[model samples]
Target: MSWYQHWISFAKRLVHVVAKPMKQNSGQGGVMVHPYRGYGSSREVFVMGRVFRQAALGRAIPRRGVLRDTADVARRIFRRGLADARVDIRIGNNQLCITTDRDGYFDAQLPVSSALPVDVSWHRADIMVHAKGYPPVRTNVEIYVPPPEADLLVISDIDDTVMFTGVAEKLKMLYRLFVRKPHRRTAFPGVASLYQALYRGKSEKAERPILYVSRGPWAIYEMLETFFQLNRIPVGPILFLREWGISWRKPWPRRAEAHKRDLIDRMLALYSDMPCILIGDSGQHDPEVYTEVVKAYPGRIKAIYIRRVDQDPKREQAIQRLRDELAHTDCELVLAADSVLIAEHAYAQGDISARGLQAVQRDVDEQQNDPA
Candidate 1:
């Protein structure tokens, strides 16, 4: 072809490329705001969310078809992170803007100038997230305003601690995660009642905040939510650790240890006056991590409970060493085999009432009879 003809063909191809839609990371469309439960004292409010276009990543799992379920499982197990999106949020009269950094997550700690009701445990506000291409998305956000009656806060790990997640065994963990519905999954005996009692704390009406931290990817957030609801556990902010991505500038996604520690630190700093109870299983880094947290803030931790999930002798010894190490501190480390032990300790500390202890015992007995 002549030079002019070749030039025209090149220009046409360029136009086609420019006009095509951007390659998307996930299948679904539309922008979404996934705000985690935020808690604050009366003077200020803190809120957080991930700004992203919907990918329908877990959409097929709940639809009840073999092929669709298989696809959803695959998506969840190998889910990709959608990141680096711009977002805007407005809480009450305070407006702030933040940009997601390679994780599609944004959080703002805004001040609450308006007066909050004295008795309520939660404060509601509208949170709006916007991206350049997608329309502005709005969602109801709750800033947990802890009541003055709250004695302490609870931060627990979900995997293997309360839920029977074979976290130490990769294949088994994947199999269980893919095959079961949220309701079908098992919660440890009496853990729900224990959590309820902790949520109610010293007073029967006090709804003290409970935060859940997990090492799993965000793809399973919906299923976890369903699981919490089905089990009648008190709902709180579900924080997840990122496990994808490695690069020259940022060598890893939110590192698991750092994520857990940073989140715990944030909570501790936010509620400086209230102590925290740390709970996790021995299958992973609970002992080591909780020990580090205790060391970081010596008097701030009220108690630490590491469930004995692993039967290994060395693991038990390590946890026992940690317990001994904390002997002089204000906190107590209890490595227990059942929720009964945890409930008993809480009762002794006046964290739960005698009636609440009885409820926990009843639930534990029922779970033994029928784990269904």
Candidate 2:
């Protein structure tokens, strides 16, 4: 209890406190980036950052209408700030203002935008930082913008084209799509870049619009967006089927359900006035559906680019029927190993010089050809 002893104890405690680990939040919402920790256990030498998704005040319920198991998901980060230090995240089309509670977690109300009824659903979210130091940082809001009017429309699939969902093995693809986490899915090569090129539109008028017409259900929109953002891919209006009803139990793997066909009708209506390019994969109903659409609207469709996933002779014959039929419509139907070549050709048609589109196309081509 001597004064000298008390001072000694205070010094020891200060060192321990400094050595304790700490975590903070980076400005990006929905992502956390930790620095690399060294041998030093000095907590003061490091910093941490976290982001959170929160609901409106007194509205503990997530506006998405789904109940989250926990309001907060805690993640640990070792070091502090560095290169690309902030987590890269997307501001979905529906994100709005945010607020923070005493604990420094972000909570916000996700806005409901269009009421347009299609099997096609959209998701919106905001970025709010939750961490120990610094005030909550809110990222500039960017909503998902649908493709503008174009001379050509691009509708495509997900599995086997954008993400490897084992479409070659139907049962496996279906199971993975329904059961896997967002982090588990693998994006197909050059898909993100191809999509971006098709969507960026050349000269606004010559710009060909793109649409993601996939058989995947809507339950994984967040995951889909995560994949796109993480890989720096392009964004577009995503069309998916509802999996909550009898649709799940349907035989033949995928039946042309009323909801799905109805969405196609809606899509056709959206492009009734413009000619379009249909980019699709042969893994599912795309061949049957795209073939029918091209047949119904003859000259309105510019071309059909079908990605072949199944090597089955019977299935290949069926897909070839659609390709053969495309000739009748005077629409060129070409098959490529992946979408990059087709997308490159589309970009060239859009008045974007070959050189103008090379950078993106190169990246896509590399991804498609890369062994890994």
Candidate 3:
């Protein structure tokens, strides 16, 4: 192709470079974006916005902000990072704002005890001229719960295990899987009830502690929490993978996996000497990851429960491997139809009372057995 033709093609592709803005309606306040783009800048922008939300809510909340570029790069970045961004109100019934600033920062408010959808967005200041459209940013709200020490640390997966859709919903899966952020997620049958039981510590001798460890990016933490609170799922600390964006084949291909492993290690460190139970689905790496944890810390891990969302040969193989590895250990591996089965096991293992465990188990059984 001639030089002019090549230039034309390049321009076409550049024009086609799509920047999708995510707008999540959950109550939590944090920026959500693809995994690669999330770790550096968007997370910081979201945390900054959360301060505005907390001020409106009349309570102080722990907030964190990260500048997207590296320290060296940050120094060279635009002086007014996010300064060009603007938050404008009035978009039909919903009050909305958009940012076109260098730093991509925007502010929003969430009144205390108030439940309303707050929307914020980021776009290039130059791109606004065409008015093609501005993609809204995604935000997740984090709800704080007093630490539940000695309680059952009910860590579970958000994908197929609780939500009916396996591998997460395709339309939304990218947001969860690649974006590494939280958005609206589906609730699996009896998951809410089970989480409630675990969170409330309704069972005798069982601590009601809930923790979520998922492949979703950290950007979605607020969205995940909001979904939980909206659906009334048990609440707790949620661990997520950071978006490093570096291609695996390149210098940092293993960064994503390494980041996850580091996160898992930190989780174990926090719960060091703390007896805990694990809950997850069979859809993804949860099986293998959980197994490794059990093997690494024998008695510390109370139980391993995998939600049978679908049939997968590889998952089955992994399950078998976990069994083989745990052959000599006391850890129990179970395929629960729903949350109750886990509760039942906990009750039997003296984690909860017979009656309380039986009640939750029955509820899940009925939900799974229901024709609707």
* Candidates in descending lDDT order: 1, 3, 2
The candidate that wins on lDDT is 1
Give a tens-digit lDDT track for model 3, residues 1-372. 676775554443222221111212122323222211111011111112311111011123222112111221222221222334354432123243455333334333212232223222221111111112334443333322223344545556665666544443644533332222221334665566666656556444333445565555444544455456655665554434343334545544344335545655655554454566777777666777778888877687778889877677777877877878787888878877667677777667876655556656676666567664
CA lDDT of each prediction against the hidden true structure:
0.71, 0.47, 0.47
> What's the CA RMSD for each of the models?
11.9, 17.1, 15.2
Q: lDDT by residue for model 1 over 1-372, one digit each (tens)?
A: 676775555444333222222122233446656676676776677777666554454554444334444443444344333476655655556666667756677767777676678777777767666567666666777777888877788999888887887755644443333344433346788888999998887677778878898887755565566567767888774455454555798775676667788888988887888989999999888888899999999788999988888689999988889989999898899988989899999899888888889988998887687655
| Tens-digit lDDT track of model 2 for 84-138 | 2223222323323333332222222232353322222232323444344435444
The estimated TM-scores of all candidates read: 0.78, 0.53, 0.53
For model 3 the TM-score comes to 0.53
